[model samples]
Target: MTRHVSTRRAATAAGTAIVAAALIGAGLTTASAAPTAEKTPGASPTKLSASQRAELLRDADAEKARTAKELGLSSAEKLVVRDVVKDRDGSVHTRYERTYDGLPVLGGDLVVHETKSRRTEGVTKAHAGDLKVDTARAKAAPKGARAVVWAASGTPRLAYEKVVKSTKKDGTPSRLHVVTDARSGKKIFQWDDIRTGAGHTQYSGDVELGTKQESSGFSLTDTGRGDHKTYDLGGGTSGQGTLVAGDDDEWGDGTPANKETAAADAHYGAALTWDYYKNVHGRDGIKGDGVGAYSRVHYGNNYVNAFWDDSCFCMTYGDGEGNAKPLTSIDVAAHEMTHGVTSHTAGLIYSGESGGLNEATSDIFGSAVEFSANNKEDVGDYLIGEKIDIRGDGTPLRYMDKPSKDGKSKDSWYRGIGQIDVHYSSGVANHFFYLLSEGSGAKEINGVKYDSPTADGKPVTGIGRDKAEKIWFKALTTYMTSNTDYAKARTATLDAAKDLYGADSAEYKGVDAAWAGVNVKAAKGKNKH
Candidate 1:
């Protein structure tokens, strides 16, 4: 079974369709470019004095110290700042985004704009009409952009460079400033904008583009290698990762120990996902570590959905009582396991746009894994969770070709798209993957008919999943983060294609065209496509 964000099966026991029949759904999360944020560079800020500026610098230094205290750096991580120009606009708005000790943040590429617009009366203080102050120049975000992601994480605080404001020729009658934390979307400072001599002026911060964050836990070298090690959780042994099953009542308990016989049906399914990645992607462990992640059989008593927890780094299983046998699925295993890999690598958050991309990334690679495994036990195909009969009628969970047909997923990106469940939100990337790998058309594999159309319903020929897998893998390793979503995913992958296939190479062109087919315009940055 394909382990995607959701387990789409027949609705029997409080079943969720992943995409509701009436909900009608969504796509790749673009970052928000609007004024939903507090203290946007173009937004107002907290007023400050020359003394305050000095204090702010002091505060930044203090932050540096705090970070060092909390996250001790290898001499390498202590000073590395991997900040580079990102986003549609080239350092276009906010002064600059910076990373402390090389920790990666979403704002490293986003330029923030905080401006104050106001009017003030001089000592003359006469009711002024034309003498009044107002904003004149308007700066727009760079063109060919998709969405803007603005958010705050519990960890990762946002830092600003310098603050600016508007004032009169002599001085300001009133003043304003805006301060924000780029990493966490937290507002640092703000103030008023008043007129003195200059009618209206906009202020900005010094762009200290943020660098990348160092790894927080368990490094790649931390885990051992190969079948040399057997994983023992509480019960038994699993060579690396395993897929176990349970009775209708007790679903995947994997117990790390076995209770009843390890369900062959469940074992085979999980094995497909495990061996697929190992044989196809050459990924020994989900994180490329030799450490084995145990797959517990029968997760819950008649459980409905399967999931991955970073804390455990393993995929769990579930039984579909009455109408579902989700444990006996291939894509589901791959989908869940990939979540482990993502947790280790990009570590995208599980909410909002980042959540959607996180889910989609799992599905994309899961589908690719299915393609690579080509196992006769679980024949490799594009259909997600084809083995699990949620409907009890033998129909699979979700379809990769026309996700919308499943009634839970959206085929394209649109406004208010983030509202859908991440499982459904995955459509944008799922569709993009379909476009990249197979293009748009009705192709039959394993007798599964897949007819996928581009965003505009136009047909797009693809580069096939084999190459697509490599390119996407490269992107995940080189350009993504815990916060990356669909738009960023596309950008990262396009950039990856060029890196792996050579600039302007056929492979790169194929990737660019694939995104275009999905209606995502090619962008720059690591975004080569």
Candidate 2:
């Protein structure tokens, strides 16, 4: 149930495990380092000439090879340089994507940290240990074998399943793993491999994007943000779709008169969200890994919804109503990308209270990203889906200050709150975040009015959005787990606040008060800061 990439899951589904095993014997490593040149932060990444970027990548590749050898990576493993980030202090962090036995390894990525003098400081591995699993007898399941997936911790292994009848619910198969002490048959691991969780268009006004330079010209692929690419679905619902290619890199005219306008908005949103995480939280990208997830626009005819699919590791959006209004707004794009972040960290299952927390996390960061952009055309607000107008009315889909304004969303937590739909239950946490950042009662920010109230009628003081965002992000990445509930969330944020602002700081007090405002109590006996 842990949220992570699973290469074996896909291999098992495709019956390619055997072939992958064969390829593992001849694995090769490629790593290069960038030139030891100092670059400032304000230097425009897009302004780098094609030749300059090529030279940088070439150096990075060499560094990757050296790093893999230093790490003692076996021939069954390969390291692919994903990004090489150089700090002003001359330190560098080189991120890599890993493959095992020529197949993608789910939790095998790592980052090599170097000092200003280019000395290897150490490495941060996503998962440790050599991937040496026996797959000779790992055959595809036969018909009616009762397929069950096995996902091991750190390193996952795939094996065929065999069902056994036992005492359980009627028509329900027994959930058990077959094991043997003999070396020939040992159930190394067993768990469900299915992972599910739950972007863009022309609505956003004049914005900037990171695009890819091509031989024909530039395309809508963002090299700065983990190489995220945007594609036009062409009104279809399947496949990776077609890449949005054009001769000129400059896209969109600030109006829906051209379809590229929507594409531009989506691309811009992705870039903004990427920058928000990198600058604010020191995260490389969604999943804290350099790999980028793509966006698919123009999905279906007048499709009004946008969703993040973990299966494809991409975000899909539908043009709304007349196909002219694309759903790719700044906040919406951030919201979807934050879902990917949640999947990698905390991994709140998209059901029950955890599901509600998952949704609210997206809403929280989505608002942060909007404010971070400081775009004049789309001023930041505490309203969700305000630009999309999915409701037809001028009102936003969800109100953080007063979530109950949506009629269906809850303003505060209560018993059986988990029984409610995740989207509605998310209102409680959204209200808590608003109260934490803006306090209770009426206030105005960026020309938007908000009147947040407490369930206990106790006034809560504001801590500002910047501090609140850091606390939440810290809790998500450091404290939360896959099944964190509301009460647990209260503890997590409190711990996060203490870690960032100290136990006696006002920021810590605000986190506790905000949860109380939402009727969530910190668990007794839990560490209090």
Candidate 3:
């Protein structure tokens, strides 16, 4: 059962200024050095400075007119720059979102690749073909349904996108997007942006946090990382709630019984996640704009779920089962935050195979962030939500090495996978990531044992977690689009691997082998193995 609550806020504006940019200028052949203390070995891409981002953004904007014309876009369509990336070889990739006759065009996003001299190399579009839909106002639509163009799948058509704000039975906040065909007043498609994951105890130990000295003592705001703050939603299920603060800097006694304890855990998770992206992947923040998203704790009594909402630009967690265990574990926090990353990058629609990929992207990064944290109390492992025990049986929520351990998730990709829920469908990529990072068969890391199997009974050798994560991040931000399915995902990762490692490098082979391990084999000639 689900509960419907009404808090009507306008959709996150499509015209919101693009926050991320790149430093991919001509003759930029060398990569920038990582910060000494947080350096990640073999991480080649450079982080963009504020001035560089502005410069690259200007470059992207200046080229949009010519790029759109080359793509054969109609005069009624306009392109807005969403992001930009550059390779070490002096090549640039600019991402854009499309608008049709002043209305947002869902699934009209694209990436234009160019060489050092601005020669058009290629383009990846979420929607192919021309946009010739009639812009005249539809005769009928759902009450308060805002008009837009739906091009994510099938044929492009005028549609209404309605967002219903509510709370799920599991206490997960809902931001359901309901799309209806405007002309016929019929349902076309819908997807919820509120991504949910279950979790266990507050495992983040006595850790360092970034806090600000407020007039009223100290606030849970981290001034260094985009001023990210934590709030206590109390028992209510909506709104931002109150910002958590205290006189002294000391926070939490490592117990969920203390409301401040959960707040501290949430705050710590945000900081660690921020550090992981900035240090490991050179990402500034969730949107790559150096702006932090907030967090809310104690949402709904006995609520056993944690979620990330793009509309509110924040994360919300519930006190699990007995209200004694808050779902603010380190992995859980990273898991939710990574959703925001996926939303901004690939904008993977939260449905079908793309949704599964979206969820897997988060899981992959969440696991990576955990290992990078290297906390003694919360050792990293392939297991997710191992500390929260949301099921009360002391078992984890999901297993990456072999996702079938949960009995609901599939261990490998198969036909009809898109028909299942995204969480379960995510097992395919989750298994792929595990194989890519740790290889097939039995292994142990940080005292956790895992045994992964291949679809064709073939053995796979890992290229290490560090390399695996870098490849995934590159593929996601550079090659992937919203409609990318499992097959497209394989190509994206392979392309990313080729970019980071050479086309003939072992890392590239590892990516192919990992995909084949999960039954996502490449075309005959391409499957060298």
lDDT of the structure predicted as candidate 2: 0.65
Error of 2 at 520 (Å): 0.6
Question: By the TM-score metric, which is better: model 2 or model 3?
Answer: 3
| Predictions in order: lDDT | 0.44, 0.65, 0.79
Rank by lDDT, descending?
3, 2, 1
Model 3 steric clash total:
6
Cα lDDT tens digits, model 3, 1-529, are 1111112212222322111100000001011212122122232456765556557777677766666776678998999999876555556677899999889999888887655556566677787667888878744555867789999888999999999988666656577899988778788888888877651125877888889998879988999999999999899988899998888988878888778889988889899999999897777888877899999999999887888888888888888889987888888899989989988888999888998898888888878888888888888888888888867899988899999998788889998998888888889999999888778888667777788999989998887778788889988888788888888788888877876766777788888989999999664442222
Q: Which candidate has the top score in TM-score? A: 3
lDDT of 1 by residue, 242-311 (tens): 3221123222233212332223333333455556655554455664544556555444444445555444
TM-scores, one per candidate? 0.55, 0.66, 0.88
Q: Top lDDT: which candidate number?
A: 3
* Model 2 lDDT tens row, 366-437: 889998988877778888878877667777778899998988889999989987767788899999998888
Worst 10 residues of 2 by lDDT: 18-27
Error of 3 at 426 (Å): 0.4
The list of candidate 1 runs beyond 4 A from truth reads 1-270, 323-326, 523-529
